[model samples]
Target: MALKLLSALDAAKIQLYHFKAIIIAGMGLFTDAYDLFCIPPIMKLIGRIYYLDHHNSDKCSVMPKETQYKTTPTAVVSTLVSIALLGTAVGQLVFGRLGDRAGRRRVYGLSLGMMVLSSLACGFSICKTRNCVLVSLGFFRFLLGVGIRGDYPLSATIMSEFANKKTRGAFIAAVFSMQGLGILASSIVTMVVCRIFAVSSNEPKSETPDEADLAWRVILMMGAVPAALTYYWRMMMPETARYTALVEQNVVQAAIDMKKVLDVPMSEIAEDSPIRLKPPVLPHPSYPLLSKRFLRRHGVDLFCCAATWFLVDVVFYSSNLLQSQIYHRFIKDNNDVNGYKLAFKVARFQAILAISSTIPGYWVTVYFIDRIGRVKIQMLGFLFMALVYFAIGIPYKYY
Candidate 1:
């Protein structure tokens, strides 16, 4: 039964269903990337609206009504930014194991459901007091982060399970490449919203106009649309044949799933079965996850993958979440730019990076990964990242 389903899956040609798998799975990643990082671009607006510098309220009317929005307190801002990362770690640990135990499809939509509800909650989180509103947002974002990161493992698993062996690398690469689209989408939405509601900066007062209050809410809520769509589509996806056959030990159910997904014929699959499955090569069948032997066998490989991914995420999300602050600090602007302009500038910069760096790198990996190999490509990537980081960091003060 294993051989029948496994061999058919391996031998199947690329079909429309394969692309469906990519789109369905890829959009989860898209929503995750967009929602997770969207906060930074609009955080200034958030501060202006919610954390309005009331201590300086007396100054607002006396000092030419010039917009004098104080920067959000550092501790609060850090919590807002880092809380999502914390939620992501928690979600991955929880959902990953759940996927293994219950079933991938069973648990996949739970993350997106959390994302849609939390994203909407963030958009509407208003309170009479400043602290109440900020805390509410933080809590909702924590839940959103849990939903966003849950897609990380599930998408790759689905893509790998469906893709033919010959080009499985490209398919999985395509799944991650969706992150670029997500980032770009978020930036474009923020930019358009800011532009449409462009408020003239008050020369006398430092407070943002009422229009910005609306714009930021729109930005936070917009993440729900795509996430909701992805949820519906993911629900339609059938469970992977590999799980149904190999893990569940249900050959008939696995065959039905394969019939729906792959291009193989019914006759070839339904014939009286006498074939045997080759046991996948492993050091020991009894070596369970977290066992000492399991660790001994895969320890170095595990460490490298985890450490590299960890470092990369640290760099990626920090730069994304702190981009506005970075631009304000070092880019050396002479004119007193308003919050809307600052946000637009940051959005533009992120768009450029997505187009030139993130998007291209992702697609290039998809195209060349199988031909050139994963390890070599990863090394080349680290080399470039190292060079760019040094170039930016070494001259931090001079710029």
Candidate 2:
């Protein structure tokens, strides 16, 4: 079996296959971000639908002079919004290990399937009682979160495996940048649905509750479309050469896969035919992460990277939690809306933020990450984040 797999990967030129890999992984990220962020714009509609104050005269009203509407309890709102995150944590841990043991390609499709099915389930969770709907929505969303989180490690691992050393970071960053597009798409989808269902701003807010009801479900299920579309390509993708050769120790199969991936002749990839070898070469020894040998070899790197990532994600998701609050505070002092107006406003705001910040931020990382090198770019990112935090009087410690 072939021994020159790593060298071949290192030496290969960028090809259509590489870009296709990027798109496949990027679509997963797109689905992940869409599912994660879609809840915020539609929260008010959820409240209007489920948290109505029946005794109030203007209960869930859609009049021209509509003044206020009931909001769900803060704790209930918090639970509904954050349950997906809890599911994601569990999914990441479970799927991360499973991807290693069972196989990346196999686990990849399962995670995506989980996303598609759970999204539809969340949408289909219409119920006669509020409690019934909340319970079903929360549970299905948790499952959706589990599926959404798997996109990260799987996409990153697959992209890294497919990329050459020189362009690896850029490829992975490109995958991540797709999240920006997903977020923007979520906002745009909300806007379009609301426009279709909602009356004009100058008109009475008397559009039937059924319209808003149908709107949120449509938004939630839209995630399933892209995710389901991506799954076919994801399953069509070959298992990575690195995993097959290095983990499974099937060097001959890895060679053939690489030949297809690299779209090069076997002779050009390696000196001899892989089948001519009597038996596969054993994979290099790997260390258990908890072992002393492994720690000594990788401890500092692991700690630094993990800590850095933890801090970033903490800030990132914290912002997500705070985003709705921030918008409501600035836009309307958290005033409740009896119609779809608030959702439409929030959607517009989200689209604006995507255009001004999120899209540019991710695309900049994609374009500059390789040229600048990872560590330096990371340092710059931290510097910018720190400056923003400091300006806002939030204390942060760098790892």
> Among these predicted structures, which one has the highest TM-score?
1
Q: What is the C-alpha local distance difference test score of each model?
A: 0.79, 0.80
Candidate 2 lands at a TM-score of 0.89
Clashes of each: 9, 1
Measured on C-alpha atoms, candidate 2 has an lDDT of 0.80
lDDT of 1 by residue, 136-161 (tens): 88898898888877878998998998
> What 10-residue stretch in candidate 1 is worst by lDDT?
330-339
lDDT string, candidate 2, 276-387, tens digits: 3333555556767689998898899999999999999888877765576754554452333444766777777877888898889998998999898899999999999888
Alpha-carbon TM-score of each model against the true structure = 0.90, 0.89
| Candidate 2 wrongly placed segments (more than 4 Å) | 53-68, 199-203, 206-208, 271-286, 333-337, 393-399
Predicted structure 1: clash tally: 9
Residue 248, candidate 1: how far off, in angstroms?
A: 1.5
